[model samples]
Target: MTQKSSVRQMIGFITDVTRWSLSGGIGYQLFLCLLVVFMMLGVFAYLVQWKLGLAVTHMSDIVSWGFYIANFTFLVGVAAAAVMLILPSYIFKDKDFHHVVIIGEVVAIGALVMSMTFVFVDLGRPLQGWHIIPIIGLFNWPSSLLTWDILVLNVYLVLNLSIPAYILYCHYNQVEPDPRKYRPFVFISIFWAFGIHLITAFLYEGLPARPFWNNPLMGPRFLASAFAAGPALITVLLVIIHNTTVFKIPKQTFNKLRLIIVISAIINLIMLFSEVFKEFYFPTHHSLSAEYLYFGLDGHNSLVPWIWTAISINIIGTLLLAFNPGKNKPMLLLPACILLFVGIWIEKGIGLIVPGLVPSPLGEVVSYAPSWVEISIALGILALGMFVVTMLLKPALIIEHRFKAEKPS
Candidate 1:
């Protein structure tokens, strides 16, 4: 536990985590290759889209939102989820998640990068995305949600990931951690985590013309689903890592995440039902967005199928997690998490994209299916996120293992 030994340990851990993310075992290497290959295809696809315009995808004026936006929204929810783990451990002093907190941060960083990338690609001219930068005259602080989104996304990303990294790093290295000296940094992270997704949800909800996005309840609903899925992902990941490595997730911590999954899952379901009731109770054209989701309306049958799928998966997933939790087998939990992940993906993807198309901006339906190019590019981003998480966690975990090993028996 001497300073030099601690520093060496810290360096080793950081290097390991870094290696796992970008370069690691054969599996990690293959993952990196997969990510690179997909991204290359995405770049090629984008070039084609730019050359021919976004028409390469099914995007039309009627269906302005598409694959990129759907992924962006869902990943924002994914990224925001890290807070559920971090807050409990740090603020609430819930030590159950102490082990998983750093991994949560790593996942947050990966997911956020993907979300931002989607925003980047979704732009008409990707390079001009810097138009939101203050030095540029294009920034309309008072008028543009784009400006706010730019500000919140970057700031929150840094805040959410940095503190846990700094703390875990210092602890691993046996350094003073001294984040206690920067308490405001931790405080800001909590609120910032919440804000990033709120702003993201607002990015959609703020749109007055798009009735689907206009629901005032959308922001909170975004948060509920995020918390539900975020920790569940971490739980599944913790298990996977345990299987692959000597490290074992503490039963206490695992149980904690199980509790979190259940609580957040129920809350998410309740919010969905609330929105549905409000929309269906009154039942008007303004409610057509939610209606279209539950049951097909007009001629747009594309999302009707997915909407029911999302509802069933989410409802079932939530119930299982809520009741069974620690009692269920890990394999059972895996499916639950998978189901939740799929359910959210469908909800965000369909809810954001196709609904915007229905009734259009001017009251018309449009046929909107993501073309192969769009699907490929979207999957490429996802594959990249998974690849990044796999890489980063491998190194970060080694650091943790060394620390735990060095601990007194």
Candidate 2:
């Protein structure tokens, strides 16, 4: 593969992706239309925010980060969770998992793009984003965790994109992808995935001023919840893909993923219990944020319902998976997976991010709720992620189906 031939092949790949994505069934076309509407509305809302400023949002000096950052935090975990599939498929050489590993890469690409979009939208002055660029801006290098986050995330995104592109290109051309060519990058991605999420965790835990996020367990808890929620989402997606397309996912694949979700969810709940007990048992000044989160502080209990709802759902979801692990039980498995996905969304997003900044470190308590503008922009970003996944999956699925049909029995 010379450079010119590689570039030409890449262009051909893009053309195929566009053609397949656009030529889907009625349901797919309708879904794409719906996403476009939401994306347009988000753009209009963002333009309003850009014109008026951060005043359009509910964030104040007391709670500088709001809904956007919360979603950004959760999506980073979702993005990093792709390692669950990559590790088993590539490192362990699980044949069933190899069939769906490309799907996980597609999911990661959508999620990483969404997470970055959330960060960009949260910026009050979007133009100042250039300040984080390596040469064009200061970037602050090793001194700033934010700089580290930016570096790892972009690198991970490139790895996910390139690895899949090379493999799928070979499949498209009916050639075997040389392990020597792409295997090293695959190995790098496995480790890079962990680094991305841990760096994100350090972004919070390193802040001593925010005692709520400063726990040493924060990194482990992040990984635990991510593995659980990320796999849960992927499970539901694989089910949907199996039903709607020619791609056939094996029963054992779901079984293996279910086990991972159950173990990770249990660990996440145990960690949650440990943190809760540590806070309420001996009640110190450091527990003030957790107190405010669960029990309310000085008559402020905005997050009490949110936290309890998340806890109850997660507990119920975990039990459902643990007790009912049958291979073909989509009725039980689907609901449990959906529950875990939604519960962890709440747990990792609002439940985690808001309280860390609520008390303002000076004992001043403030409340935060997303404005309509924020809601619209967040929905738009989510819609964009779905669009990306749908587009990428169309071509990838076609390639997978073709290769599977060609394989010798």
Candidate 3:
């Protein structure tokens, strides 16, 4: 193709993407509108936060991190979970996942976008976030896990975005993508996925002051829970796509994903149990953090109920996904996925971060709760992610429809 023709095609593709994104069913439009309202509210709340300062948040000098960082940590795991699908479809050559591997990539992109947004919103001086840039800012590269996290996350985002964009661009033009061009990147992405979450875990585990977070198993636990939560969300999203749109995902593919969710959830449970045993069995100074989390230390028990609720839901989700009855019933599967997703979010988001700080290294107890403004901002961040995912999926679905039209019966 000539350069002029290529430019014309690119412009045409953008036009189609915009049109398809705008054109959706009433239900879709309503959902989009709802998200916009939440986003606007979130923006208002963030402006208030920006105006007043972090003082508006429940975070004190002792409990410095709150809702934003919790979500950020959880989403890093969710973003890495895309590797679960990428491995089977790309490495194992599973034809069943070929059509939906793009879906996983899209999920990764959306999750990363949210993760970065949370990081952005958490900043007191949002403009100074650019300090992580290599040459312009003091990234503290060799010494800081956070610097490593910034590098891996942005690179992973680019890699995930590029692979699917290339695939969809080829499909948009009714041409087959060359594996030679994109397959190597797919391989690199698999390792990069692990690196992104590992670096995130190190960000916590390397903190010598927080003994609760300085566990050797933090990385493994993060990976296991990430695989469970990530695949569980993808499963729910796939079902929504299957029901609401013309896109058809095979039951065999669903079954494969179900297996991944089941195994990962089990591994995550085992790790959780192992931590409980380690914490409660010997009972050291470090045990106070876990004690405060699970059963409450002294008179403080703010997190006890939330932690147990997370555990109950996780157990229920694991059992539901493991059984034949739940596997066969779509209704049961959907709720199980929700339970697992919510359970992990609660566990990792608030449950993981708060305990480490509650019983400070100096043994001072300070309770932290997200104020209304913090909650509003979180809802807004989530709404923004859903909007992006919804927009991205529309274009991809349109391209899929075009493929179906061209396919020979």
Top-TM-score structure, candidate number: 3
lDDT of each: 0.78, 0.91, 0.91
Worst 10 residues of 2 by lDDT: 323-332
Which structure is stronger by lDDT: 1 or 2? 2
TM-score of 3: 0.98
lDDT of 1: 0.78
- Tell me the TM-score of model 1: 0.91
Write the number of the candidate with greater lDDT, choosing between 1 and 3: 3
lDDT tens readout by residue for model 3, 1-409: 9999999999999999999998888988899899999999999999999999988888888888999999999999989999999998988999878778888888898899999999988888987877878888787987989889989999999999999999899999988889999999999999999999999999999998898999989999999999999999999999999888888888888888888999999999999999999998999988899999988877888888898999999999989988848554679989999999999999999999999897976798866789988999999999998888888988998897787689675
Model 3 steric clash pairs: none
Model 3, C-alpha of 83: deviation from truth (Å): 1.1
Q: Give the Å error, residue 231, model 1.
A: 1.4
Residues 51-126 of candidate 1 have per-residue lDDT tens digits of 9887888887777878888888888888888888778877877766766777888889888989988888788877
- Candidate scoring better on lDDT of 2 and 3: 2
When 1 and 2 are scored with TM-score, the better candidate is 2
Give the TM-score ranking, best first: 3, 2, 1
Q: Write the per-residue lDDT of candidate 2 for residues 1-409, one digit (tens) a residue.
A: 7999989987887898789889977888899999999999999999999999989999999889989999998999999899999999999999989989999999999999999999998887889888878898888989889889999999999999999988998998777899999999999999998999999999999999999999999999999999999999999999999989889899999989988999999999999999999998998898999998998888889889888899999999999998885544888899999999899999899888989997887789877779999999999999999999998989999987887789776
